[model samples]
Target: MPIQKVTRDEILQKALGVFKRQGYHRTTMDDLARACGLLKGSFYYYFDSKETLMKEVLWWVNRTSEQRIFSVAYQHELPPDERLGLFLDRLYAAVLVSEGGCIMGNTVLETAMITDEFKEPMLVFFTNWTNAVAHIYETAYPTAQALKLAQQLAAEIEGSLLLVKLGSPESLLRDCRERAINRLNVPMHDCTSNP
Candidate 1:
């Protein structure tokens, strides 16, 4: 058989799992290569360094979140309650409830102090997340209050995810979700309803 070509996205997808499980510092290039079914040398062809690969992984995650989670906040036809619930549900499914916890959170704790490059993408992720939640909250409150509530909700969910990672009951996440919906003060309805 001839040598197979690996796309950048394929490498990043495999690398993300390994990085999430083993963390940025603990994961070696060789480990990422194995995860992608490539030799160590081939891994270098895709990324000049682990940091470069990790940055792209963060970008990929941000793009995925924009599509699946943040977009719900922009659906003006949906009630705020339903939109918030859907966004939270999609978020939990995508990134929060994983055994490895939130990749952005994990990366922040590991690499925030060491490099500006890593921190920039992580900051963008949180800013985008906060803005999305704020947009939903704006349905009920003034711009200032809505932004405050959005920040609080974002922090609360992150804290809840940390608790889950530390062996707290997963219900903690569910409770956070309920509290967010209630805080928005919009009546709960079927998120799937046409709006």
Candidate 2:
């Protein structure tokens, strides 16, 4: 059999798991190396430092998540409300599959006091993601109103997911979906348009 090339992605994927479970500050480079089945010195051959590895991990996770969110958002030809619901379903599924618990948010919470490198990337990620979702919401509502709605809805979903992960409370996810739908269905100009 041809030798399976162990790439940097393969190493980062392993490191992501440890970071996901333990958070950034709690997880060590040694833990990442051990999880990846590599010696510390060998791991250094691939990454210059732990912060460098984390930067790559953040980029990889955000890129992966962006594709997933965009795919779900674009695939639906339905109304904006329905499309948003489907997008949420896809996003939550992607989060679970990635096992990273909102990589941008996770890093923000874990490293807020430590470094600007982590915080700056996270801000950009959230801004881009919220803007993308707002674009979809704008299709149904006035463009002027879509930004606030998108920001609120994204915050709700992200917070709900964190709660779910911390408490294993599935109902929180359902509650967030319900609240989002209620808020999204309201007209930007008139709250009673649907009725």
Candidate 3:
């Protein structure tokens, strides 16, 4: 039989799903290899260890979210509501509503206290998220108030993700998005976008 080939990006993406669902401590190289459709031993050809794969996964997730979701806040050409609303929509679609729910958040909860390997990328992801959120809130309030509101938004959305992991309805996230938009005093009818 011919050997199966996979790209590093593919391996990282697959590893992310497993890590998100099972966490860093619970996941094994075997689990990653299976997810990537490679043999257990094949992982060494790509990643030196599960820790290496996880660090790569964290960076991959951060890069992807930064480009797709968080960067929307920094796009100054867009209106405040559109930028924030689109950011929330893309955030829900990419992370919150997913089966495992926010790889960065889940990984931090599992590995942050035990190991420092994952801390840098994890902090980068959350800090970027908080900064992006604070950027949107800055449009309405003073700098300090905006930062506080951003923290509040992060807390609310993160808590709602916990509900999603518990088999709660997606409406909880929807409500969070709506509240986020409504806080900007955007009309309720304007929130037609949900992904």
Candidate 4:
């Protein structure tokens, strides 16, 4: 009998969970197959190799995150900082809590040493995201300055997410953000007002 199309989505979703937990280099095709309740041969039928599955999973993660952040950034009802904060909060919840970290960050950390192909997409995602952040900062700062600050903030946030995965307490991240918020001179009252 032909299996349902939903089964493939289920397998991919489960594979994503395993990949998120064990990371790209650490996870084997067997691991993903087991997580998806499929035999290794069956898994191979759906995905040619572990790398192919990983690339698709990482792309899904990036696409979902981009949509969420873009939704907040483009929404007219919310101010820039408020929208950014909402996005960040979603980020913290999505990547930081037990799932360990962002899939792009995880992919970069593990495969960056091994392959250029993996790093390319991660770079593009960061470039676009950092540009969006810079645009938001432009509401308060000069364009050039905002772009510089956005790069710095993007680096800081990515590093902080890595640290969170490494088991540093959340307060350390919050402290870093507080210091950054001060340095950016974004009014604190605005966060409370919009939230």
Collision count for each candidate, in order: 0, 0, 0, 0
How well does candidate 4 score on lDDT at residue 108? 81
Better of 2 and 4 by TM-score: 2
Root-mean-square deviation of candidate 1: 5.5
lDDT of 3 by residue, 95-191 (tens): 8444589888787778778888889998898889989987987776666666776778888988889887898888998888888766666333432
Question: Against the true structure, whose lDDT is highest?
Answer: 1
lDDT of 1: 0.84
Candidate 4 at residue 160, lDDT? 82
C-alpha RMSD in Å of predicted model 3 compared with the true structure: 5.2
Q: What is candidate 2's TM-score against the reference?
A: 0.84
Model 4 residue 175 lDDT score: 65
What is the full ranking by lDDT, best candidate first? 1, 3, 2, 4
Model 4, residue 99: C-alpha shift (Å): 2.8
Q: Which residue ranges in model 4 land beyond 4 Å of their true spot?
A: 1-8, 179-195
**Model 2: residue 170 alpha-carbon error in angstroms:** 1.6
Which 10 successive residues of model 3 have the least lDDT summed? Answer: 186-195
Q: Evaluate model 4: give its TM-score.
A: 0.82
Q: Which ten-residue region of model 4 has the weakest summed lDDT?
A: 186-195
lDDT of 2 by residue, 1-195 (tens): 222346898987888888887888888888888888777777888999999999888888777767767555565577666767777787777666656577667788778887787876677677877777777777657765677777887788788878878776867777776776666666556732531
1 or 4, which is superior by TM-score?
A: 1
